[model samples]
Target: MNAWKMPVAWMSMVALLVGGCNKDEQNVAPTDDNEAITTATLTLVNKAVPTDTVRATIENLNTTADFSKATLNLKANTTYTGTIGLLDKTKTPVVDATEEIREKVNEHLFVYTYSATSGSQNALIVTITDKDTNPAPGPYPVGLSTDMQTGAAGTGTLNVVLRHQPNVKDGTPNPGSSDLDTSFPVVIQ
Candidate 1:
């Protein structure tokens, strides 16, 4: 081959090799977002009263709490059917992350913990009444919705935590990365 022809052949071979080395997107696993939770709203509807509702929204998922802005106040000695809604408010119209969580219920769990005060000994109790069991090997309790009961009239803080525990959820608060950890000031009267 001529000297100029040799260089042209070498360039053509290099181009062919580089073009053939394109990444196989089929083999590349698509990633689900583990973060970017912008809002968490906990809604409680009174089963007895029917008209009463309590909503606690924790905005600014990336910052400190603004208790004055978002709080939950409920009547004492009441049973409230609690529903938690997670959202990625950074989107154009705000996307609901709860559904994505429901799709991965076996790997997700919501935990509700309350701080005890002098007036309200057992201030709050949370029961995982509803569950989502799919993507099989399932029957896991996904606490996107729950039952909440208030003991007595008191003031406390309700902390809600959503954990992503894939394949290691033994019905405990341990073993997972916290998708959202937020608290709301609670008053029962």
Candidate 2:
């Protein structure tokens, strides 16, 4: 082939290779968008006594947080079945953020961290009872539902963090950006 034509052919091949590499970028799925959360409610029902229920709510989370009702009063040495309800009050009809999180369970995770203000260091133990729909290596934990067990009579803080993991959730809280991070006071008697 002629010298100039050969150079043109090489340039064309390089362009084709670059164009082919961008195909995957075009086919790549968009990551899940984080939900706007305005309210977070945690309801716990005693395992032994179902009638005994403790509810805590944190409202106006995106702006001025109203933590007045955000307190969990529990009985020590008791296990409670817990569920978290998240809401986006900014919407016209009000969106249930919890349902959205459930719909994208594989892309979302809730991390519960407890710190004792008084009494035992490990005052509350929280185990996520719900799992995501991630395949094979997954079925990772989703904290929408949890089993909370109290250790001793103590006052502590329960920090609830909702992470938007997208394609990186591996049952750990480190992979994603926090969609919601709030704390609720806990009093175990």
Candidate 3:
């Protein structure tokens, strides 16, 4: 009886030790699938003249034309108020992907890169004017809307990239997978 009791106690202790060491929760958050974005529209309205507006869009999510070209014509050295919207055209009523991005604002980010036709970077000044609070306890700017300013009369490319950054978004465009990336031919005339 004593031998049996000793063996049983040893097995119980071993089980307890192993169970206590089990990793029940993961350090990283579970990944969520990115929304299927079929179209990206950027509407820029002149700040001085409310009626003057220009739009650039990228369409064709279901075909090879996904990387279609868009042109945005603007005045040189002008300031424009811009709003960006994303849509999923596969649904009966095109799903407003911008709303989904707003819901997960903390986990998503939009990065705007500008380059001149002559290959000079930072040709345009793009500043995200709005910000959203994160669930993990911080605030970061989500690029659904922005204030854009043209530097000078030049041709360039404005690249908009939406990044899906679950647990690792720290403002910069360094730590996530690109959800939507599109380039628009920008002419500041």
Candidate 4:
């Protein structure tokens, strides 16, 4: 009778352990999916002269990308107020992905990287001017709007990457998966 009781107790403990592990698995939250972006447009207005504007649009990003207008013609040694617009053209009436990103501002981050072309001395400098509505020790960059400054007359490739951070945004691009990564030709005249 004593041996039988010991065996029953051991089995009950194992069952409880397995059940607890299953409960933890069920309590884990699901991650959000990446946004579908078919087009990305960057509009820059000269800070000193609003009339001097530069616009670059890259369409069909998910399929055969059209980069005809992806060339940015900026003035050298100038500052421009820039805004980015994203779109999902696959939708019937065209869905504005920029609004969706704005709605979940805390979960998205845009990272910009520039590489000067061969023999070019200067590269584009992009500073994100928008912030997410996170609380203290928070309020990270959203990158929908930015201040772009040109150094000198040069050419470079500007890479724009949109990261889907969800609840893990820490003001860095290393926290999440990339939703969009594209490069535009930059020419500062």
Instruction: Say which candidate scores most in lDDT.
Output: 2
Clashing pairs in 4: none
Report the lDDT tens digits of candidate 4 across residue range 72-92.
Answer: 998888999999999999989
Model 2: per-residue Cα lDDT over 70-126, one tens digit each: 999999999999999999999899999998988999999899999999999877999
* Candidate 4 lDDT score at position 40: 97
The worst-scoring run of ten residues by lDDT in candidate 2 lies at 23-32
User: Predicted candidate 1: what Cα RMSD to the true structure?
Assistant: 4.0
Q: Write candidate 1's Cα lDDT for 31-88 as tens digits.
A: 7647568888889999998789888887878666455557888888999999998888
Please, what are the lDDT tens digits per residue for candidate 3 over residues 66-174?
4344688888778999999889898889889999998889888899889898533544799998787865455888998999987668888888999999889888789
Model 2 residue 181 CA deviation (Å) reads 0.3
Question: Candidates' lDDT values, in order?
Answer: 0.81, 0.94, 0.84, 0.91
Candidate 1: C-alpha lDDT: 0.81
Error of 3 at 98 (Å): 0.6
- How would the candidate models be sorted by lDDT, starting from the highest? 2, 4, 3, 1
Worst 10 residues of 1 by lDDT: 131-140
Off by over 4 Å in 4: 1-32, 118-122
- Comparison by TM-score, 3 against 4, better one: 4
